[model samples]
Target chain A: MSDRLSISVRDLFIDYEIFEDRRAAIRKRLVQHEGTGRRLVRALKGVSFDVFEGEAVGIIGSNGSGKSTLMAAIAGLLPLTSGDVLVSDEPKLLGVGATLMPAANGYTNIRIGLLALGVSSNEVDMMMPQIAEFTGLGEALDRPFKTYSSGMRARLHFAIATSVHPKILLIDEALAVGDQAFKKQSRGRIDSLLGEAGTLLFVSHSLEQVSSMCSRVLWVEQGRLRADGPSDRVIAKYEAFVG
Target chain B: MVTSPEPSSGLTSVSEALSTREYLTAMWKRREFTIEVPLEQLRSTHQTTLLGNVWHLGNPLLFVAVYYLIFGVIFEVNRGVDHFLLWLTMGIFAFQLTSKTVMGGANSITSNTGMIRAIKFPRALLPISVVISQLLSFGIEMGVLGAMAILAGVGVSRRWLLLPFVLIVHTALNLGGAFIAARLNDTFKDVQQIIPFIFRLLMYLSGVMFPLERLLSSLGEKSWLVPLAELNPLARIIDLYRWVFLGASLTGGHIAVTTAIPFLVLWFGFRFFKAAEWRYGRA
Candidate 1:
């Protein structure tokens, strides 16, 4: 694939407030006091990165290190306190326990998922069988989603998320849930997705997997980018630091 | 890969949110999601009940029946309004639609945090879908009200054609209200609890169960309450419905104000809600 920038996140900042008590928050506001009952956690602090087309990049970070928040901000799921995210197209976020209708069967959830991704109704019809096949749920595809095991649910989510072939895809530790066979199938699907010049930002805890699959690795430390380089070089540093 | 052009220099102007036109176009494209998700939600909402979908119609009917018992049967507070049943129906149904839409819209964002973070779609669709869901329920309730009106000596007339126009204006107002409510509720959790009480007070002021004209005549035309009661879009829309459905007297000034207020509120509400589109998910 040619080297064209597909995703650029510049000086991004995201913070979330924890409201410990509902009444306290209300009282604090009414009393005209600032920071009396709320705590602001800065999840991402002026982080910046760039991804080119067809690049498979893994984001590695310690817990509370803002890996997921960075992915979410790129997808426009989180509000930015400052900075900018320039993208060629909307980024699809693939995460575990996505809110597909639980009462609806797997097949219906597939249809809903496709439509939510802005797939046309006719396209949804054309894509349903393909997704259902990939999910490999067979007869269980007709059963309610709540009836599925966690592994099955993850498989279905991965299948539906990949069905649209988004130009930019963000996977947030979703692959960590499924079994070995499903994981193998998902890796194959992601490979094909990247083969089409799509950009991928994968957040995972597995260093070995990141070292193997990713061409580049970004190590995020306390809401900032500590290192960005070749996978082997950065993962080694990350491992040494953690160990 | 060879070194690429500096991304920061080339993409520095990229704002955090989509442009207004771009956002609306994208939302229009994914309009199907707005309908499909909410319809499925509405359908599954009552599956556990023995009565199921019947509760949609039954709940509104039960509510109207309680009001009727108090004002119609017990106190006989008809207040010379012809076809009191139909008047009450129009007022209650119209008022209820807006109230429910506003409250439902308020909860839309908070209830769907998982969906918001999982998929990429215009967050506005959530509030829009809530309005649609409530409108669907209102449509069915209107059908039952129509049947009841027919049996109560109210005849269909050419004025009935204006009902569509009334509904269009009412929906615009509801859409705008939903947008504002959705954003406020996301910022302040206390707003959700306070909304129902606010709507209850609106129900009394909007003349949902009683006639505003009676109150006006007693309070005097020059009283400050006259304009307050007359200018409220809910009251005006309910009055427009009464004018068409029950042949009640409605002034041209009232019609003009009712129609104009909805569009104005719609424009303001859409802009107000759009300004905060980026903030819906972070909290």
Candidate 2:
């Protein structure tokens, strides 16, 4: 990894307000004349880190431990309750559920996805063959997206998301789907991306996958960072704590 | 072999909003999304129906015919306008565009939570695309209206040339309403449930089935209601359409008001929507 900083997180905090049902909320306001039926969830609390250029950092945590939240914040998808996340370039987030249009066919979705990422229409046309080949969903590309199997959908989403080679890519459990062959293929793609000096922040539950793909790892517990160090060291610590 | 740009040396706060100039430039670059997605939606909208695309023409025709039957035959509410059916057709067609756009915009953000969370784009495009699709539907309806006017022996005139200008102003008004509704619905979720009733009430007040002049004259004692009905933007838009199609009377004051209000609403609505830009997909 280079000395140049690619991402800097300065005590980032994110709070999600979970509001009660509208009808219940209205009833409560009328009856209680006080409670708004809103609860604040502190998804991230004063977490700070700095990622250097060309670094592949994996974030690991138990369920609801803010791993996904941190990834989303770094991707600039979440609003900050306090503090800041600074990035050198716009980051693209690829999650298992990142969908474009469910009714549109896979080809149409691929075109719109690239267009949404600010790719020129002509470039989108040129990239069609490459994206189509990567999806490996030939002929099935004409079928509506809602009809795709979960693994098939993940393949298409990953192919479209990585089509433009974003300088900073944030992934959240997006590689867990698909078969062994597709998994190997996707791992190859990720390697090629990192080979180009791209920065990645991958959030996954698989310690083995994280240790294999990332040289550095961040362990988050609850809403705070528990550890940040070399992949093997952090993984060992996280494994012991979990056990 | 497109080489990716080197990572910038300097880091900027990710939560901060883009400058207006930067935002506009980014939006312009994605203009194809505003056009193509709506066209695709319009294409797929009728895919499940047996009649397919014919519903685009048939839907509006059936709508106007039903209203003509109720207001024209049963109630005799045409108010003695020349070519009463054509006048009612113009009013209903124009007003439906606004109502449909507003209704569509209400759910534009809420319904597309998946795309919003996955993609980072100007949320304004959601409401804007709804307006474009509604505008396309309006165009098809206007084509049918034109054929009806020709068959009914309404002579074409210079005033007909003003139809596009009037339609543009109407679109601006629809877009403004859409932006405001989109943001509100994103926050409350109840806005979508309430919008249809609101539009139904607006339909009667906007003179969709009857003439505004008739309402003004009938409300002689309640003279206060005159300017209110006359100033209703939807009423004015419908009146403008009537004036274009049937050579109906349109005053200079009405023209100025119709042209000015939409732009004002558009400016305010854009600001209102942009204020909550970062908060859209939190749910």
**Tens-digit lDDT string for candidate 1 (B1-283):** 2233565533433345578898899898889888887788788889889999988888887888899999888878786878887788788889989999999989988888777778877788888998889988988887877787788878777998988999999999999899889889998888999999999988887888887766677898789877877788888888888888888887434768777998998888889888877677556
TM-score for all predictions?
Answer: 0.92, 0.95
Local distance difference test scores for all models: 0.83, 0.86
Error of 2 at A28 (Å): 5.4
* A1-243 per-residue lDDT for model 1 (tens digits): 555788877788888878778788878887867556888899989887778889999999999899988888887777678887887767888887776678888888888778777888889888788888899889999888889987888888888888878878888888887888888898898888889998888899988878777989999999999999899999999999999
Q: For residue A46, give model 1's deviation from the true position in Å.
A: 3.6
Off by over 4 Å in 1: A17-38, A146-148, B1-16, B220-223, B251-253
What TM-score quantifies how close candidate 1 is to the native fold?
0.92
Candidate 2 lDDT tens digits, A18-120: 8757678777889878788777889998998888778899999999999888888888878899998888888999888877889999999998888888888
Clashing pairs in 1: none
Clashes of 1: 0
DockQ of the candidate models in sequence: 0.52, 0.52
Assess candidate 2 and give its lDDT.
0.86
Determine which window of 10 residues in candidate 1 chain A has minimal summed lDDT. A1-10
